[model samples]
Target: MSYDNILALNPRIQAHATLRSTVAKKLDKKHWKRNSDKNCFMLSQPNIYCFEFVEKLSHNIFETIH
Candidate 1:
């Protein structure tokens, strides 16, 4: 799956519970740096899930997971 797909799936995974905080908590600074580097990740990317997206997706994913 593409990164967009995975990011899109984030909502399905979150189920609406604030993905930003959840994801951030789950991924420490090191993890973020690694993932970012490996994926050419930019949190500020236009389409990708930035902080706000993560927050929204986390909420969605959390609800769905439960």
Candidate 2:
């Protein structure tokens, strides 16, 4: 019924693993970026698999699809 509930019910969520750490790098701040437009922290990594960055990225991807 709701987005969080939908995410909870997603089977793929259980298929993968969650990272032990919060951010990729605890001390280094270089892995973060400030987008004047999005105003959100962007993970400086190859894949968007990091859980912290998922919600915004999901909306972005679905925006393109719709």
Candidate 3:
């Protein structure tokens, strides 16, 4: 899923923003072009994978209406 999709699904997951930023930074180092892509610049495969790895993490995050 896309970053926005993930964020929309689980706004609470934003608590992990520092971790996400670290992952994005690593990705940026490997793929310079991603830095030019606004969306890609803020997210990365590792970041997405990290979220996916946690079971029910999304559902728990979005359980309440914002």
Q: Model-by-model lDDT, in order?
A: 0.67, 0.63, 0.62
Q: Give the TM-score comparing model 2 with the true structure, all chains together.
A: 0.23
List where candidate 2 sits over 4 angstroms from the true fold. 1-52
Rank order by TM-score, top first?
1, 2, 3
Return the TM-score for candidate 3, rounded to 2 decimals: 0.18
The candidate with the higher TM-score, 1 or 2, is: 1
Give per-residue CA lDDT, model 1, range 1-66, as digits (tens): 789888986655545765457667766765656444555355346654476777899999999999
State how far residue 33 of model 2 sits from its true place (Å).
25
Which RMSD values do the candidates have, in order? 23.4, 21.0, 25.1
List, residue by residue over 1-66, the lDDT tens digit for candidate 2: 889998988676377776666465543444454534353445554456556468788989999999
TM-score, per-candidate, Cα-based: 0.28, 0.23, 0.18
Backbone clash tally (model 1): 19
Compared with the true structure, the alpha-carbon lDDT of candidate 1 equals 0.67
List the candidate 3 regions with Cα displacement exceeding 4 Å.
1-20, 33-66
Clash pairs of candidate 3? none
lDDT of 3: 0.62
lDDT of 2: 0.63
